[model samples]
Target: MASASSSIIPPPQPPRSSSYSYHVFLSFRGPDTGNRFTNHLYSALDRKGIRTYKDDKKLRIGDVISDELEKAIEESMFAIIVFSPDFATSSWCLDEVCKIIECKNKLGLQMVEVFYGVEPCDVRHQIGTFREAFQKHERKGFHESEKIQRWRDALKQVTAHSGWTSKNHPNL
Candidate 1:
């Protein structure tokens, strides 16, 4: 968490488009990286005068989840998904990914994937802990099959992009 630039190649700067309210939208598993890496990332963006939306409760499950989040994703110029060991464990995170990707397709929103402590291929294939997480999601039936499938497809799509990995950039 030295600064995102110190850890890996810095993502592109925000465009001067008037439609975007923020330069970046950060998505991560709170318990896995909230107090540590993400905070430093936020600070880095701030120091560079980049408007970043870092919602702590965005990954939280509750009545608080709403369309305002969808709006945030749409308005942001770019998104950064920090994939950690427990990232796929939360349904909320997957839901967010769906929205992030939807905007990526519809609004030309760009994305940066950071495989924080997990393998990119594992996420792409849903293996290891990702496999375990999906199994639990299916067993619990907390969401419909189509919804779960969308999450899987989203993971596949996200991982296909060229991304930064902790395996390659250990300082991240």
Candidate 2:
């Protein structure tokens, strides 16, 4: 019998200089609150002299995970998730959330979640419509998948985080 060998690999280092005060990564669902809240949030952040990264304007089908989007997420100092009523409906949004959580853990990046029209408890407990949508996704063929687990983990992490809600503003 042959013995298995393992090798160690060093983790990638984050950028040294923090040039921008806040490098913002905006994540939102398109049909839900993408046009309304996301646009306003992006504009406000830009006006406040904060660097922000957002998706393209044109709505092209199957245009998923471009290099620009990946670079933006990687360079961002913080990620902001605008959680609307239909946020959990899109798999793309869920995937983005997973990536944001990954960055948070690996690079010490910060995160802010805004529950626009939904209650925090709904997200925290994965109850109500969220549970239904998630269940549907699983039934549609996502169950027992690593990506689904990651998405679930990301949602839990975001809900557990201390952030601002549309109804209640935190003291900045």
Candidate 3:
């Protein structure tokens, strides 16, 4: 397995200097695209020597830690969020989404969302599976009302950015 730093070629010109440890931080639901789309994308990026961070660590059943994962996000030049069917269902994934948006806002970290077999409208509006996920989150009440609202805002804010869909950008 190639560590993010292992490279056959230099990374493309990003806005940042060599202070960045990785070119991209990949955020996704493991079960949805881990073995398929995200995996393939990571592999392709690796082939191109684009230093990328994909969380392969098994997570504990707690809030997404602000240590390694957060550090990786901060260290990367940009992020690619793979919004799949069940992405919104996981609190951890939603948490990461919030953190990614935070980084984008505060650190000027760029992000490009990829709607993988999902609709950007659905994500932005919280319709379809996304709607269901939020309903479940509300019913569970595991998170504070304010935290949930932040997640909602993050979703809306993120989807506002121009991105590629599997249907339109089939080449990826």
Better of 1 and 2 by TM-score: 1
Candidate 2 achieves a global lDDT of: 0.70
Q: Number of the top candidate by TM-score?
A: 1
TM-score of each: 0.87, 0.77, 0.84
Kindly list the per-residue Cα lDDT of model 3 for residues 1-172, writing each as its tens digit: 2432233223344565558888899899999999987887788787868788888842355746657788888888878899999999999889889999998888878888888889999999999999999999999985688998999999999999877688765654
Q: Each candidate: what lDDT?
A: 0.82, 0.70, 0.82
Per-model C-alpha RMSD: 3.1, 12.3, 5.0
User: In model 1, which range of ten residues has the least summed lDDT?
Assistant: 1-10
lDDT by residue (tens digit), candidate 2, 48-139: 56567777543256755655565567778877888877788788788888888887887776777778777777777777877887988999
Ranking by lDDT: 3, 1, 2
Q: Following a full C-alpha superposition, what root-mean-square deviation does model 2 have from the true structure? A: 12.3
Clash pairs of candidate 1? Answer: none
